[model samples]
Target: MPEPIPSFAALGSHPLHPMLIHFPVAALLGLVASDLGYVLSGDPFWARAGLWLAGVGAFGGWLASGLGLIDLIAVRRIRCLMTAWCHAVLAMMMLSLASLNWLQRYLAAEPILPWGLYLSLLTALLILLTAWLGSRLVYEHAVGVEAKE
Candidate 1:
């Protein structure tokens, strides 16, 4: 008989969906924090870092989402589909926003557009909600984690 395939659970939560997620989480959070800094202090540098962090987070978000999706699929759960969909949509949104933000900045080396402030805020909120859904999907629904009794 063939050897049984290895399971992600063996590696633990960090690598599963929680680990490797800090980049995007930190990026998005940093975007908001830095944006606030910019607003409070009017420091162009902080604003720049915030925008760059959004771009960085978007890239990491894409990878994390991909990993989450893959694990979601491999584990196979109804809630996972819903959770994945939520995360996927928001992730795409975040990625697009970050891309647009970076493109605009690259073209002009400027701070994020004024409206972008609101958009990033919304994106961060959605990402946070998506993260919650992901937790529900795994911890509550046993989607990506091992099947429970």
Candidate 2:
């Protein structure tokens, strides 16, 4: 069976997942820093900044996930399909945390409490782990590289 056009397309020579993933990873990590700033300084500015970061991270994550899904679906014969699935699940979990964190702040008017801080920290860790898995797909499994003739 043939893969769909969107699944196989790339931006220039690079796959979209690699290109689009950095934004959400960076934004999610930034959200953790902003959470710390708000907690230590008790400034609403940091809280507001965290809110914005969460929203941006969620948006970027959605975009990246779309690309990742396409790639995952297209490459059915890859060696590290399990790792890719794990990465996808963890990425979605982290994105969900970011979205929920933002919703708590924006919609429910919740403060940057200890629980929220802990969740942000956890999300940061998940991003790191998920990134490692993604790297494994490239470095260990060679999922996206063109095969040498």
Candidate 3:
């Protein structure tokens, strides 16, 4: 068997990228639900929730991606994998969408209907795709897995 590729952006033994990804994933996905809640109930509360979620998701995603980028750049084995490149590209695309979504909500006082919802949905989809590619790196290629001695 091939040796596992350890995470260069790790904190001690734990991989920082994986550890930090859950928050952004949950927050970004929740933005869709919050937007839907605003649509269904016509409450400004949901819209406000969406704004917070978007900001948190976009910021947190970038933070995690930064660590992952470090690992991808610093480790030759990770850099050589096509899955790594795909994951990186998709992650960047997703982050861009997320940032745009946040910016729109931040700058606009109008309702978050139509366009915001669309952006949220697109960002969520990209997040899923990026996550799948990232999972393949960890599960299939063992990109951040450490072998037991």
TM-score of each: 0.74, 0.87, 0.97
Give lDDT for model 1.
0.65
Clashing pairs in 1: 14-19
For each candidate, the alpha-carbon lDDT, in order, equals: 0.65, 0.78, 0.93
Can you rank all candidates by TM-score, best first?
3, 2, 1
Give residue 22's error in model 1 in angstroms: 2.2
lDDT of 3 by residue, 11-69 (tens): 88789999999999999999999999999999999999999999999999999999999
After TM-score superposition, what is the CA distance of residue 26 in candidate 2 from its true location, in Å?
Answer: 0.6
RMSD of 3: 0.9
Give the better candidate number (1 or 3) by TM-score: 3
Q: Cα deviation of 17 in candidate 1 (Å)?
A: 3.2
Q: Which should have the higher lDDT, number 2 or number 3?
A: 3
lDDT of 1 by residue, 31-118 (tens): 8888788778887898678768877887787776677656645644442356567766766776677666656555655455575577
The parts of candidate 3 lying over 4 Å away from their true place are none
User: For candidate 2, what is the TM-score?
Assistant: 0.87
